[model samples]
Target: MATINPVKFIQQVRAEVSKVVWPTRREVLLTTVMVFIMAALAAAFFAVVDLLIRTGLSGIYGIFG
Candidate 1:
């Protein structure tokens, strides 16, 4: 079994955290807006596809019933 020293682990964690390049506020906001736009577009596309499928199924039932 490998043993981990708590003090050494904490020092390594802090070092790694300091090396991280955090995203700027502008970049975060732009990406958030893009995600919302993509989500809305995806929802709209799925709604249209559902409507088309429903219409097709209804037509099929009407023809057979």
Candidate 2:
């Protein structure tokens, strides 16, 4: 098995972390708003589809019954 060096590992981790480009506050807020908007739109679409399907099934039952 190879030997492990704790000090060298910590230094490498810090170096990589420093290279990361973190998102700005504006970008985070915009993306968060977009996510909420998309979620609401999706929920509205599914609700309409469900209503249409239920109405169709009820009509079909009424015709047969």
lDDT of 2 by residue, 2-52 (tens): 988999999999999999999999999999999999999999999999999
Candidate 1 lDDT by residue in tens digits, 1-60 = 999999999999999999999999999999999999999999999999999999999999
- Looking at model 2, the pairs that clash are none
Q: Estimated TM-score per prediction?
A: 0.91, 0.93
Best candidate (score: TM-score): 2
Q: State model 2's lDDT.
A: 0.99
Global lDDT of each candidate: 0.99, 0.99
lDDT of 1: 0.99
User: Model 2 — which ten-residue stretch has the worst lDDT?
Assistant: 2-11
By summed lDDT, which 10 consecutive residues of candidate 1 come out lowest? 56-65
